[model samples]
Target: MSESPSTRHPRELATAADPAWVDAFVVELRLLGVPGDEIGEHLVVLDTHLRESGEAVDEAFGDPREYARSLAPGGGPAAAVDRSTVAMAVLALVGVVLVPAALGAVLDGTRVTVTLGGVLAAVLLGGALAGLVLPGAPLLALLVRRRWVSFLLAPALVALGAGLVLLLPQVLVRVPAPLVLGAGAAAVLAGSVLLARAPADLVTAPGERASGGGGRLLGLLVLPVFALVACVPVLLVRLLG
Candidate 1:
């Protein structure tokens, strides 16, 4: 006799339904003002549907964001515009730009002038680009959860590398390190505050608890790795010069 679909392994069922898709759906629902309890109930129902019908989530419900918006009475295009998220992305970009410049200035014991043009370019171009990209970043992270570290670090490293390349000439000329460092620190702090206020559940699958020992250990290592990577340019410049 053939085994029943409900009797199949839960993990096997979960594997069939993409965890990233499920997580993104839950996040979208939450963003639309669905309470956590209701969201959890929805996910349970979704999982059962996926298991019983064996239909892909996209085929069954369409895009998670759009589906969630439809469920929310007034959550239309206006609901998508999260001012705080935009601000956080911009602040993060500014921090990435400033931190390296500050480090170079501090190392060289020179004062750096903050040009109006550079500030405008960084805020307008860099921040706008970041704002456009960040809303989708959590979804991307979930999609690549197996390589989460790389997914998280790649952008930061690229931004840091780019900033170093742009600021190298100025640093060599001895711009004030303290001033730059202060600005960078402020931007990072403000960005962090904004991020803390934003929804973080996009990275977590529905019904899954937060990571335990091994995951916590990995999370602890992320900061050190970030710091090490951020300092690479400064170290290279110091050594080569």
Candidate 2:
């Protein structure tokens, strides 16, 4: 005989309790060789199923694991975003490659010009990738709980990466690369703040609303000064090296 919905387990009623867990779940699903689109679609379905089942924001788990059990017979939900893993993998590669390459390019000479242009390029690419991978980590969980705050960090990080890229040339040229690096670091730091207050429907938030909110304001207020101070050591070392 078939089991009733009420007799269903928590996996069947998965919620956002922690997006990071979802991320892990995604990774596990991938391990089982599920496609990306199917993963995303199933995620959407699972989310809806959970909400409908009366799951709250942060509930851990119920009697039986729903998704796991479902996999046993009906198979899991279909993938949502296609090649999402591939896209994320590419971004991760960008982060791994570009940062070092940018550093090398800047350090080509003792009197390197850490211009904004290069920094912007690196950060824009790097930040986005970071944002993508972040959902699978603890940070995503924290952000999911605080929708407003978490959502705020997403764009803030993007802008910060861009801003730093723009600032790099100026800083490395002797005016004080430390300040600029510090600014970039500050942006990253601000990301933490933003994460602490993320929303549930993160993708749905407006672009302006996501970034221009309190997190951006705070980042704007602090990054410049922080960048100046923080980047100094990095500059000195790069120059010396």
Best candidate according to lDDT: 1
Q: What is the C-alpha RMSD of each candidate to the true structure, in Å?
A: 8.3, 14.3
lDDT value, candidate 2, whole model: 0.45
Candidate 1 positional error at 232, Å: 2.1
Off by over 4 Å in 2: 1-117, 120-128, 170-241
lDDT of each structure?
A: 0.58, 0.45
lDDT, candidate 1, 1-241, per-residue tens: 2222222222332455677676666666654546554555466667788889989988988887777677665653323436876776666666666777677767777676555445544544564365344644453334343456666656865576457556643322434677667777777677666665554332223444332334444433443344446768887999899
Model 1 error, position 90 (Å): 4.6
Segments in model 1 whose C-alpha atoms lie over 4 Å from true places: 1-39, 50-69, 72-91, 124-126, 133-175, 189-228
lDDT of 2 by residue, 23-132 (tens): 55654454334544345455556577666776643352432234533552246443333344434345334333333333443555333354567656655665555544
